[model samples]
Target chain A: MTGQVRTVDGRVAGRRGQATRQKLLECLSEMLSSSPYRDVKVIDVARMAGTSPATFYQYFPDVEGAVLELAEEMAKEGATLTDLVAGRTWTGKPAWAAAEDLVDGFLSFWRKNDAILRVVDLGAAEGDKRFYKIRMKILNAVTNSLTDSIKELQSKGRVDKTVSPAAIAGSLVAMLAAVAAHQKGFQSWGVKQAELKPNLALLVHLGVTGKKPTK
Target chain B: MTGQVRTVDGRVAGRRGQATRQKLLECLSEMLSSSPYRDVKVIDVARMAGTSPATFYQYFPDVEGAVLELAEEMAKEGATLTDLVAGRTWTGKPAWAAAEDLVDGFLSFWRKNDAILRVVDLGAAEGDKRFYKIRMKILNAVTNSLTDSIKELQSKGRVDKTVSPAAIAGSLVAMLAAVAAHQKGFQSWGVKQAELKPNLALLVHLGVTGKKPTK
Candidate 1:
């Protein structure tokens, strides 16, 4: 578990400091949604939080540092994604259900934190290791679980041995993440949201089972 | 075909003016790769182009305007992606080859223009219609062709009738784009670039033909 929240000066944040820090994060989060990451400034976040810029600096070195702090918080919540795949059977009706649940769960999570995830994705794509590590922290929770499910099937000869579980799982997760990020793109492409989800579930089922789903 | 290039003021750019304009775009494109999109400025691009900011203004309204011009050029190149699927037969070995070639072609194109494409992606994801349209112009060139191929297979009963060709094709193209955008992420996950391509081809072949490739 994460230790107590601390200020930039290394002092553990007291209740008042923690409250101010949380307010600043909330304001920063809003700025990320409304404006591009590069345009988000500490002064703006501080003004929105009704605090001084010096106080903002006391909690975070810079905007990127605060964004990383926000991302770490989200990564902790991402741990819940394990339930979407762990212990889920990939056979018959249950397999169909599993795919649907996974797609639904994954999409909802991405939608909820899309603003931060976008910055994380951009930073990671730009080769920033800090952002990349945070992205992996969030995605690996679900990806590792799916990889295990695929490997379990491979062991029983239910899936092909030539198929790399890690690759397939990673690809499928990438597909899900991409689709979730561009849900509006799909809608504009003439595929409705309802129609889009089922097809995504179909692809997930196909990727995991290597066969058309029974449903 | 596009008519003669024009400045933001609606004047047709002559040879000398066009050269300055193109230089500004080239400089802006380089800036996009080297710096974050939000931080890219018209003044810097103009300075790098060895011209005044007024010259940059004559050619483009803002950084985003110049970026849209660049994206337009890339979308024209993306039209070539249609050849990866348009006339290719998708039965048996030919299907596998088609999938491999599509993956190869798409990944190379993405890698070549990733920096601009990243901004375009961010713009589109932020609901900017101009950027979204350009993105569609690029991806639709492939997605529409893949959709037709799926529909063709469905007509012959090679693909299931219940499947939505648009959805399946969109998902596959999204997968390719996502994978291309994050090739390094795969490498870091122990799935090398070499390993990643074949698995992507397999999924593409499976999604299109609904069966394992002959290879």
Candidate 2:
């Protein structure tokens, strides 16, 4: 748990204050979805939340601070992505199913928090440590789980020893994240969403299991 | 060829005009690397370029327009990426080498134009059709070639028939691009650049051939 919510001035927020803060975040989230991150002014977010700019400032220092808070919340939710890979069997039809589920879950999670994730991705890519840490938190959930899967397979001689489990897992997770973020762009290339999932799943299975899936 | 360079007013740029425009773009590109894209203003770019804001406007309608121009230029250069995949064999030891070369080439390209590419990626993800088209133009060069390679393999019955070549190629290329853009981030995950390349190449080979590389 994140412990007691505190204001920028270091005061613990009461129930009413937390409610107001949550409303501001929801309004800011909506604004991010509708407009560019750079153009989302604090005053506009405050107005959208039916509150004064002064009240907004009490909860957060600025728009980036609020966005970071949103990212933190999403990162907490993203931790559950580990379920898509943890303890999953990488053999036979189940391997294929595991890959399919991962691709599906990842794409849906990305589609859900796309706006905030976009900012997190940009911030991380730009070398901001806070954003970078949050990005890693979300990705490591799945990447770490997948890495263990590959390592276990390698130990059993089911996968190649020459393959670096960490690298493959990291790359595969990155692929899923990238593909999810650009799901719409795939449509423009004449690849429908329905067609993309299975292919992505196929690649995931191929990378992890080092063999064609049994379907 | 892309035809005669023209200003926003539709006048053909002479040699001198072209040089000034190029300088402004170079300056803007530098600003993007050093500052957040949202905070980058035309006045700052103009000041850095040793010109007035009026001169910046003559060549570009605004900062985003100038970024699009830079992205367009990068996309043109990116066409050469087709060489990394085009006509590359997917059999034996040569297949492993091809994968390495493609990964190397893609990563180097992303590093060279990271700043502009970052903006382009964000724009495309935000549903800006112009940025999406430019992103497609760059990725398509490699994606199209890789797709053809997969299709050829599939036709020979070497690759699985159920696999969608475009989707696989797109996913693989997306993996490469995503990993490339976040090469620095990988280090934090304990994946060094030297160690990262071979593993990425391994995944690329597996995805394309559906078998581990003979190497």
Candidate 3:
């Protein structure tokens, strides 16, 4: 159940307070997209929201705290990514489709929250535990499921015993996240966006099933 | 050919000038590792370098410009990555060795310059042309060579024609870069550094040859 929204000082936010809080978040998200994370100030976010710095402080402690909030919200949406892998049978033609659909869903999710994800990435890469935890919350949704799938295959002797499911799954997930984050970078290599998805799917299938897709 | 280093004002940097420029760059690089990229200031670098901000200006325009310098230097070092792929055999045990060597070399390269590469990664993601170009310079070195290798295999009917070589190669390289960038993130998932490498090499070999390595 959703808990009551509370301000930094612990008072529950009313409808007006919640509205302003949401407004500040939206403005902060926009600022992150337009400028570097370090340059994003709480005062600037409040100014963008047409409110006072005092009002910004009422909801969030600072820019990093607000960013953590945004990242947490994105992680909730990232939970839906489990559907991309959960119960998907990685067998024959279905395996190819599973990989394709997973790639499609994951990329779209990343593209939607790329700005906040970028900051989260930077934060995690910089060794910030809070940001790192939020990133793990997101990627683990798909990774854990995929890891389970691989382990299932391994148990059936369908996959190699030497393969570590978690490493492969984590690497594959990292690949998707990296490719999604820099989708434009592929264009310069002459790999068109349309072509990237299936190739990625193929690799995902190979990484998971250790075989070329039947399709 | 290595050209003479010059100050921003067009004077050829002598031994002393070059040393000062190098010192400033070293100091800036240290600052980037210790602090956020956006917070690294010319004044701090100058102070750390035991010079004035005016002297810092004499060598580079600003923090981003100096960062570009550092990235360019790292890109030159990245050129050596070509040895991991260029003119190398990609079949049997050699293929496995190729993949392992690449993973070893690429990871070391990223770890060595990770602080600067993080800025380049952020800049590329944010659509900054200069930063994007530098990032491409570093990745294209290996990606292009790997692409040619895949194309060679495809032409010989040793690989799938349906597979986009550039897409597959770029994705693999992106996987390497991403994995290298978040090497620490993998540890949290219970994948240690030693186990991580061989699994990555396995995926690279799979993506490249469309078969698991003989080794």
Report the alpha-carbon TM-score of model 1 versus the true structure: 0.95
lDDT of 1 at A52: 98
Model 2: residue B45 alpha-carbon error in angstroms: 1.4
The candidates' DockQ values read 0.68, 0.80, 0.78
lDDT on C-alpha atoms for all candidate structures: 0.90, 0.93, 0.93
Q: Find the 10 residues in a row with the least total lDDT in model 2 chain A.
A: A158-167
Candidate 2: C-alpha lDDT: 0.93
lDDT of 3 by residue, A72-115 (tens): 99899888998999999998999999999999998899889989
- The pairs that clash in candidate 2 are none
Relative to the true interface, what fraction of contacts does candidate 3 keep? 0.81
Question: Could you arrange the candidates by DockQ from highest to lowest?
Answer: 2, 3, 1
Off by over 4 Å in 2: none
| lDDT score, candidate 3 | 0.93
Chain A (alone) TM-scores for all candidate structures: 0.97, 0.98, 0.97
Better of 1 and 3 by TM-score: 3
Model 3 / residue B210 / CA error / Å: 0.4
The superposed Cα distance between candidate 3 and the true structure at residue B23, in angstroms, equals: 1.3
